[model samples]
Structure formats: structure tokens, C-alpha cells
Target: MTAGEALAAAAARLRAAGVDSPARDARILLAHAASVDAARITLIAPEDLSPDIEERFVNLVSLRAVRVPVSHLIGEREFYGRRFKVSRDVLDPRPETETLIETALAAPFGSVLDLGTGSGCILVTLLAERPQAVGTGVDISEAACLQASANAVLHGVEARADLRKSDWFDGVEGRFDLIVSNPPYLSADEMQNVQPELQQHEPRIALTDEADGLSVYRIIARDAARFLSPGGRVMVEIGWTQAQDVCAIFDAAGWQTIRVLQDLGGKDRVIQAQMAEIGN
Candidate 1:
């Protein structure tokens, strides 16, 4: 079949199975199967796909129809203009997290520490963008640490990014002028209601605290000061409804300069706070 015909068929199947952005997903999977850039797919739309490419595209579409994330199938996800390798072992980097990236880049920091760095998108992006900055990324899951490490290497930031397995700050050391996280902020109740792509394809540990979802924030608020350099700032991506509670957690912990920043969607997506400077 021609590339366009295959995409149309795949899209129809995905739509029937309730996949969001079916057409987009079909186009991307086809590009991956054909070993070409997604942007080039349009140029090939009228061409006949090779036998192997067509077969692979069919298999990818089948899996996607079953709710597997396109990133998991294609093996990479774009974040902050760079693509990072991903799998079921890591949380797919969502566009919302870019808000944290923008806020982090807004400030100048020589060192950064990323907690729960599932895919290393945040840490790697920062180091790649700043060139002179260095960062450490930690995750509780060994698999996630490996994935993050691979991503760091993929982005040519391996020399500047320290990827390791640590539950939050357990094995982390030193102080960072910037601390950032996109921690699991979904509550147990919310988890049950998330999209099938999250519930089935993504790692569960990266999606929730297995409780109220604010536990990680509480921990960060209470312990981050010990790991942050004097005058350092902490920025975190949050669920839209979580700004009030997250801000309160940081406020009560004496975090000054607390500010909530919204995403492109106008939803509260990131909260920035500063530890007490040299003097309060």
C-alpha cells in the first residue's frame, strides 16, 4: 500500500480504538518504521512503502491502537526541542514539563540537581542549553536511571550530567544553586482516572506517590534546603490543581519568593520558590 493509504488505515484503526491524535500518531509511527524523519513523511506520502516498512508500520499501529504510547513505540520523545530516548520504564516527557525548563533557563545556575529524573529530559536539556552548567539526576528505579543515562549520552551531555539511582535525595550530595523536579503528583484517586497510555504504558512509580500525591512536595520542602546552595531556587512542575497546596507546602517550610507560573495552556504548571538567602 502507499504511505498515505497506510496512514489513513492506521489512523482509522487508532481512532476506532480511542487513541487521541490518531492521525498524528499514525504519521509518526510510519516515519519511524520507514527510518525517516517525521517531517519527511509528507514527501513520501505518495510513495509506496517498502515491504519491511509497511509490515513494521502495521505492527506499530496495532500496538498504538491498544494504548501503547507512540514514544514507547518510536523509542524517543521530543522535549524542549531535543528528543530523548524513552520506554515503558520511564515517564513520557510531556509538553507541560517544558514550563519548568523555561523557568530554569530564566535563571543562571552553575549546578543543578534533578530529582526523580525519569528520562533525564529536564537535566539533559539544561546542561545542553547552558554548556557551562553541570547537573545530577536521580531516580529510584534502576531502569529509569539507565534510561536517563542513555538519554544524557544521546544528547551529548553525558560529561556534564550525573545520572544515578536515588530515591529523591537519599544518595544525593553537595549543593545545587537550582533544584528541579517533575515528581509524581497524581493522587491514588487521580491515577485510576488517568489516560490508558499513562495507566498501562508508562511506569506507575513515576505517576503517583501512591497516596495523596503531595508527599514528595512535603519531603522536598522539608529537606531541599539542606541540599540547596545558599540563595538557590527550586522549581517544580505540578498538576494544575496542585499550585495552592504545593505553594503552601513551600511557604510553610519558609521558602521565600514563592511564585506559581502557568503553562501555555494557562493552567498553573510550575511553582518556583527560593530558600532563605544569606540572611532572612
Candidate 2:
């Protein structure tokens, strides 16, 4: 009936459904239903649910109980301190991917390429952070490209960001000073271990390549050099245990100066490398 009461009830329902972080999720959903901030949910006194708000809250909680990602329910996720629209069509942006953005920003580049760009969070964030830089985001899913394009517009970087529907480098052209990707790296066996929210709700093409996790990395390793400027850099997010194998892929491709960067959790999160100079 009231905001607090509705939140409490939704949290109980979610908890009973085995949802993790039920209370927190309930608060956020309640705020979305009320069209207010989550922090403001606590300030609303009892008897304020209003029939319409109550109904919306109930529906959202039910969906969340099914393990649908909150980002999809709310239609947005925060990445690199900015909100990017998300959907089942795109991979929900993860905090660990920020490592790739940080690594990209550490150096100066006038152009960037983001393969399997998904929601365009990585490419958009980079272009937003570097006003002079322009970037292209490529995704196999046309819906994902549209979502990423909307996010680019939301971040006021649409003019500098190009969204293309392409499988890896197929439709992409020209060379970039920096190329980055968080491609589908999970193996079929590893896919079985992914959380229900990801395994069931998120797009499978964005999660695993259906074989060894290294398949996408191999493709990137094989094709990235042709799309990269001489001495240009390539950065990719990798599975925690994939540093050695991914590094080997890049090495075999003749990439020079390969290095692994860790996330805040100190996991091997990103592999950065520079293309060998022309004639070298």
C-alpha cells in the first residue's frame, strides 16, 4: 500500500524466489516505479504508494524475481560513471570492462575501434573522455548497434561515434590508432557455469563463441593488424585464466609489446599490445 510496505513486500518475494540482493533491488525498482531516485525511496512515508505506482512496482519485482537483469528492467546501466541504455539484445556492461577504457585513455589516440561493441559503452566512453577522438563500434546484432547508437547520442558523442552492424571486422574499414574489444570469450563448457541472469537472459552470441573461449581472440589476433595503424595498440578484455593463451595468440600474430592489465580485483582483465612498426 505504501512505498516502504511495497518495497518490503517485493523484497520478501524476491528473497523467496532466491534472488540475491533482494532488498537493494527492490528499493531500486520501487524508485523506478515512483519515478524518483532510489535514495528518495526511503524518505517517502507510508501511504504514498498510489495505485498506479503500486502496480508498476509489483510488475517490476515480478520480472526481477525471474532473474532478469535490473539494467534490462530499468533499460539502462551505469558504465564509467555514465548511463548506457541496455537490452536483452546487448551484453550488459560490466564494471570490469572499465579496465579497457582506462587502458585506452592512458595513451593519446585520434581514432578508436571497438569490436563487438554491444551497448557501445566502451567506445562511447572513450570518445566522451577524449573530445578530439573519433571512434567506430561494430556489433553483429543490429539491435545492439541501435542501442549503442542511442547511448552515443545520450552521451552527446553521437557525432564522434559510428555504430556499424558487422561481424568483427567484416564491414569495418580503415586503420585505427587503438582497437579494443570485449568479445564473446566464454567456452561452451564455461557457458554452463555462467550465472542464470547471464546464461538465460543475456544474448548467447555476446557471451561465448560456442567453442574454446580463445576463438574470438584468435580472430581478433589474426585480423587486428590489418585494421591497426603501424605501432597502433590493441586492447581486449579476457577471461581471468586466459591471459597466457590470449597473449600467445597475439604473439603468434606478430604483435609486439603485449602486456596484461588487471582490474581492481587484480584479475587478468585486459590484454594490451602494440602492432609492430611497418617493415619491422
Name the candidate that leads on TM-score: 1
**What residue runs in model 2 are displaced by over 4 Å at the alpha carbon?**
45-47, 278-280
Could you give me the TM-score of model 1 versus the true structure?
Answer: 0.97
Against the true structure, candidate 2 reaches a TM-score of 0.96
164-225 per-residue lDDT for model 1 (tens digits): 88989999999999999999999999998999999988988999999999999999988898
- How big is the positional error of residue 146 in model 2, measured in Å on the Cα after superposition? 1.2
> Which residue ranges in model 1 land beyond 4 Å of their true spot?
278-280
The C-alpha lDDT values of all candidates are 0.92, 0.91
State how far residue 161 of model 2 sits from its true place (Å): 1.6
Every model's Cα RMSD, please? 1.5, 1.5
Superposed by TM-score, candidate 1 places the C-alpha of residue 219 at a distance from the truth, in angstroms, of: 0.2
- Writing each residue's lDDT as its tens digit, candidate 2 over 1-280 gives 7787788889999999989899999998998988998888878946578889888989999999999989989999989999889999999999999999999999899999999999999999999999999999999999999999999999999999989999899999999999999999999999988888998899999999999989999998888888888778999999999999999998998877999999999999999988657321
